[model samples]
Target: MSEKLKVGITIGDVNGIGLEVIIKTLANNRILDFFTPIVYGNTKVASFHRKAIGITDFSFNVINSADQASEKRPNMINCWHEDVKIMLGESNSIGGKYAFLSLEKATDDLIQGKIDVLITAPINKHNIQQDEFNFPGHTEYIQSKTGSKDALMFMISEELKIGVVTGHIPVKEIAENITKETILAKLRLMHNSLKNDFWVQKPKIAVLGLNPHAGDNGLIGSEDQDIVIPAIEEANEMDVFAFGPYPADGFFASDNYKNFDGVLAMYHDQGLIPFKQLAFHNGVNFTAGLPVIRTSPDHGTGYDIAGKNIASEQSFKEAIFAAVHIAKRRKEQDDLLANPLKIRKLTKDRD
Candidate 1:
């Protein structure tokens, strides 16, 4: 049997449902069969969450570092040894402080090749802002850390895959940000990600317009006609099978998204609103165009029900699964590339 992949998980916020979901997701021993789970956070914090959730049987094997992670057990690396105050269901600076610590520690290891993939739990964007950790979210942070010039906020699910041109930016700034170069860059990222990361043979990507009804052909706005349309043409000229500056409303309403392998939205909510509405519980946020593989649950910290034991771990679990699958596929592709003649011979034999 092949060796199991090592998955490094970061505790988002001690107060939020991050720990709760992490514990719940790792409770099942069956998951250990595919990946060795290494959690970067305080074990005491994890214990607090495990007990609060009324999970009496589940416990983590506390270790000093990722090198000691066990394949058959859920292992935790304490990011800090100092005692932390548990403030469940609250967003505060303390929560943000520790969230950053956990993320930094795990990500440092990820950069050093200590872990195969990283699955981050939900973190409150507002509270998690600091001098060193100043970015829109995890996607931007990871991008900067890994020196990736372009990264796509790709949302993946069983049904549809969506990418956004503008992520975590204000609505008013979105218009100014949607340029031909930017749109074309995002299209390129989405197209390549579909082909490389997701293994779509011939990815047909659907692009959405910035203005409502796709600018009504310049009646509503000219960005779609002037900028977006030309960018789509450029992508096609470059041999990317991309189509449409489709009206966001009608495109999703008529089930048009189902016809394409991927959808490219002008902004965040344009894609996520419909995606979350459809696959809220199963959607996985994948950071594409990065040297490292990272995935996170689609939902945020359930602050309202942090300690109520009501938070579902389905999305978090799916994020872990997605990270594992993508990492394995990437390795398989790499192995195939190492033996070009074998790949070509396999292709010829198939034909």
Candidate 2:
């Protein structure tokens, strides 16, 4: 039988609820069946979060490498051994420093193929900024690391999947940054991801407009007509089933999102705001169109309820589930396409 897939996890911002959710999720032990999880973080810090949350029965098995990770136990790699203060619910530099440390180590193993998939916890983007990590967020940083030209910030849930044209930019700059070329790129990426990662064949993508009421048929803005519409047409020409510059406000309100395989919003908030409102506790932030698969919980560093243990781990658990399925789907797809010519010849011989 084949070995279980190795899932590399990063504990983001020790001061926040990163470890809390991770501990809670792994504590169940039932999750080890799908993938052997290798967490990149210090064991001491993990214990600190565990005690703070009053979880005494759970513990992580420390290992130095992915190969050393136990098949039955929850494993961890001690990325750092230095002593650090644990100020829960605080957004400080210490939190960001260690968050990067864990992420850096996990990313290295992922790139080296030691780990099959990656699941990152929430990080404080502002504090994590440094010489080594200066990108807007994890998606951009991973995109650069993999030498990928672009990556889509895909938000996935059981019922809905959404992607944005512009991410981590100022609201004023959104419209300016969006164009026909950018929209078409995201559409193509989203289409391929649905087929490759989620195994959706012939995916139909819904595109949202930049302005209200879909620019009121050009009464509000011209970008919907001049940029978005043309992009959708070009995507369709390329054999992608892309449709609509729907009004963002009414798309979710009237339950129109249920009909499509995926939705592409014009900007960050236009997509995320509605997604969070609907699936905040269990949504996953999947970075699509990259060589490697990466996913994280939809929520961010919960500074307000960090050590209180009130933060729910549902999103983190769901992220793990998504990562496992996506990794399996990708591997299966790769295996099937590895030697397509041989399979074609066999089919011809049968005929």
Instruction: Summing lDDT over every window of 10 consecutive residues in candidate 2, give the lowest-scoring window.
Output: 341-350
Candidate 2, residue 163: how far the Cα is off, in Å: 0.3
Instruction: List, residue by residue over 27-104, the lDDT tens digit for candidate 2.
Output: 988888888989999999999999999998998899989989898999999998999898888888999999999999
Q: What tens-digit string does per-residue lDDT give for candidate 1 at 1-351? A: 135888999999899999998999999999888899999999888888988989999888999888898888999998999999989988999999999999999999999899989999988899999998999999999999999899999999999899999999999999999999998888888888887888987899999989999999899999999999999999999988889989999999999999999999999999999999989889999999888999999999899999999998999999999999988888878888999987898789979
| Number of backbone-clashing residue pairs for each candidate, in the order shown | 0, 0
Off by over 4 Å in 2: 339-351
- How big is the RMSD of model 2? 2.5
Query: How do the predictions measure up, each by TM-score?
Result: 0.98, 0.96
Model 2: how far is 61 from its true place, Å?
1.2
